[model samples]
Target: MKLRRRAGLFAILAAIILAIAYGFMPKPLPVETAEVKRKYMRVAIEEEGRTRIIDRFIISAPVAGFARRIELDAGDPVSKGEAITELEPLRSNVLDPRSRAEAKARVAAAEASLRAVKENVHAAKASAEFAKKELDRLRQLFKDALVAQEKLDEAETETRRTAAALRSSEFAVEVARHKKAAALTALKYSAAREPEEYAERVIIKAPVSGRVLRINHKSEGVVNRGQPLIEIGDPQALEVEADLLSADAVRISPGTPVLFERWGGDKLLKGRVRVVEPAGFTKISALGVEEQRVLVISDIVSPPGMWAELGDGYRVEASFILWENDNVLQIPASALFRYGDGWAVFVFSNERARMRKVQIGYRNGLSAQILSGLAAGDKVITHPDSSIKEGARVRLRKERTL
Candidate 1:
């Protein structure tokens, strides 16, 4: 009985030691894993953009006048040469105390200027007449051999100069007369104390057959000549304007393929690079960072029927395909971690995390191209943490497919 009890106690101690050893063993780290892909890989640059008409037309006031109230609004369709608005002559100011004094002073000043110019004209005519008589006398004396040829030439030159001065003075008198007339008219209209009546209005027409995109003035008001009144454009012919970082714009060339999205459309719109503007501008980002940005114009290659909803200044997101290839090895960007000067990933092999150094090529926001040190169908830990180590035992919590 004693021998059997001793053997049972020894067995119990061995069982306890085995249980402790099992408890101390490390458990496999549960992690998310993804497979290396052998499909096509595309690296693109994406930025927010806005849609605009490829050709926009702005109509401005043809003359300085009082613009009539606009009956049309933005988005209203218009035809070429159709009258959009009318401009009437501006009304004279009401004859208030200060305004009446100013008008009277202007009239008096213009009358004085007209008198001065008329006197100058009379004096110039007198001078010209005296020069002509002197020239005739000089010519007669030269013919009688009494005056030198140089004296006769001098007299003729004086006559010609005086004639030109007379003509200039006459023109000045005409200008002064017009000024006086304008001043008198202004004073008379102000003193009439009656509301102005419009006898004629200049009609402004649309230059293009399209919808009005914007209107600078809506109500009747005095407007100057060449003041922009409305903007018109064809919404069907659309182009996208995207501002990209200066560095990225340099790599883009005309004819690059582009994909447009988030333009209130169900499907993506297609476009191609039409131009990369040569100039760059400074723009402030939301994070308060100053960046050099360039405008990249992209023509919508999609048919008009596909993006009919797009209009001028509509918001969109554009992705420029910088590089792409079919049958290239790639992996999820999350599977990568910085290892030395290159990159590394915890490749899942034989139920363990095997540290593998990788050579990376093109990388976008979501995925990266694997140039070397990895193969298709290999599993790598995604979002690996500090708990994960080289040669650590691991188990797949979930499998991610690209």
Candidate 2:
């Protein structure tokens, strides 16, 4: 009985030791993982932009005038030379006595002065010619001693005085003629038809064919010179103006491919970089942080059928294609981790998370190109568990939907 009792105790003790050892064994950590994928990911720089007209104009008043009539409203389509607005002159009635009588009186005064100057000029010319003939005759008689020296001197002096008087009279006539001409010009100006009388108003014509985008003058009143009247643009000539950080702008150049998304449209519009502005401006972002930004203009190359709903000034999201890869090994950017100043990925080995050192190449926001240390169909731990170590056992959970 003693021997049998000792054997039973030994078996119970062995069972207890085995149970304790099993409890202390390393447990497999549950981790979420995904198979490393290879996709054609384009490296891009994203930015905010707005649709703009390729040609835009802001019409302004060329002269100060009252807005007597407005023939078109905002959004109206206008053709070149088409009248858009009109301004009437301050005075409209030319038949009124106050205007007609004043003009007639001025005309009569100009005619009278002109007639008087003509008669005076004719008389002065005749008198000057007669004086010259008399002086010539006296000089001949004095040379032949047929006339007294004092008499000849007196004749010459009289001739000279007559010539001076004629010249003075001629000058007076010329002055009168100039005065009459001035009066006549003034009268013509007074009798001229006012702008309203001719066109009934000053017509504001469209300088170019376009759709009016905005009308700054809302009421019929005076609009000062240079004051904005309306904004016009060609809807068909649409482009995008994107604002990018200075650092990103430097990498962009003309002819680079671009992808554009409208504010609410699901379709992506393809475009090409047209211009990268050389200038930069400082702007305060929504977060109240000041940043230097540059404008990049791109031309939408996608057929209008794709972006028919887009309009000028509409907001959009643009991605500038900086680089691209095809049929290459790539993984989620989050799958990468820092391994002693180099890049590494958590890969599955023997159903456990293993830290595999890797060499990385070009990458974008969502994915990184694997230059080395990874292969297709490899399971990579995207959301690694904290309890999982390099050699620890792991249980892989299904990937969650993005």
Candidate 3:
């Protein structure tokens, strides 16, 4: 009986100690996991952009007058040289005698001014020609070491100045002719003894074959000279304009492939970068952050009919493909965590969480390319937290398996 009691007590004591040890031991951690995949991967930049006509034209009134009601509405198609609007003489309830005299005097003054401008244009042309020749001669002399750099620079500067002056003089000639025409029209209208109904109407025609984008004035009203009347452009010649961060803009160059989506179409549009403007502009983002942005123009390489539903100012999401590969070993970006000086992931090995340091190549918002320390079909824990550590026992929910 004594031996039986001792054996029974020892067995009970062993049971209690075993239960205590088991209770203090770390429990299995339930975790979500995903398999490392070997698949195609791409690193890209996404930004919202607007569609615009590549060659937009804004037609304006040539002279101040009473504009007749525009018969066209926005989106109305017209051919080149089609009359889209008319301009009639400004309705005048009274004609002043002094105004008539002033009109005649203005015509004479305008003629004198036009002649002087013509003479100036001729002088500017001669000066420009001389500057070009001087620049060419100085360039040759510079190459032979016969002229100093300063002299060469001065000659080049003078050439540019003369060219600019020549252009300005030519533009001035157009302005002077317009003024002369205005003065003559004023004189002719002032000579009318009664209301200016005798004045002829001027027809405004479409400068290009395109659909009207918008009308500045749909109803008849008084208009100023050079006031924009209508905007016109071909809807078929559409390009996307995206303002990208200057930092991102530098990474992309002309001919970069792009994919456009969410543009209210079932078709995925393909395009290529055409130009990255040399200049940058400041824009405030929706988060109130000031960002320096550059305008990136992209050409729609897809058939125009695919994006026929798209129009000016339409919004599109542009994905610029910076890097891509067909066969890449990648894992979810969330599976990675900072470990020491490098990045690491929790690999599920034999029902235990194993710390793995990995060399990563390119990472975007979702996936990361694994350059080393991992292989295909490896399962990695996602959203790892404090509960996970080296050699810790882990459980894979039934939905996930290695």
The best candidate by TM-score is 1
Candidate 2 yields a Cα-based lDDT of 0.81
- How far residue 247's Cα lies from its native spot in candidate 2, in Å, is 0.8
Q: Relative to the unseen true structure, what is the C-alpha lDDT of residue 343 in candidate 3, on a scale of 0 to 100?
A: 99
TM-score of candidate 3 versus the correct structure, residues matched by position:
0.73
Across 205-319, the per-residue lDDT of candidate 3 in tens digits comes to 9888999998888899999999999999998999999999999999999999999999999988999999999999999999999999999999999988888899999999999
Q: What are the per-residue Cα lDDT tens digits for candidate 2 across 127-241?
A: 7788778878989988998998898787778778777877777787777777667655544545255432446556788889989888888677778888888888888899999
lDDT of 1 by residue, 172-270 (tens): 999998998888886777625675677898999998899999999889999998999989899888889999999999999999999998888899888
C-alpha displacement of 331 in model 3, angstroms?
A: 0.8
Model 1 C-alpha lDDT versus the unseen true structure:
0.92
Candidate 2 has a TM-score of 0.72
What stretches of model 1 exceed 4 Å from their correct place? Answer: 98-188, 191-200
Listed in order, each prediction's TM-score against the native is: 0.77, 0.72, 0.73
The candidate that wins on lDDT is: 1
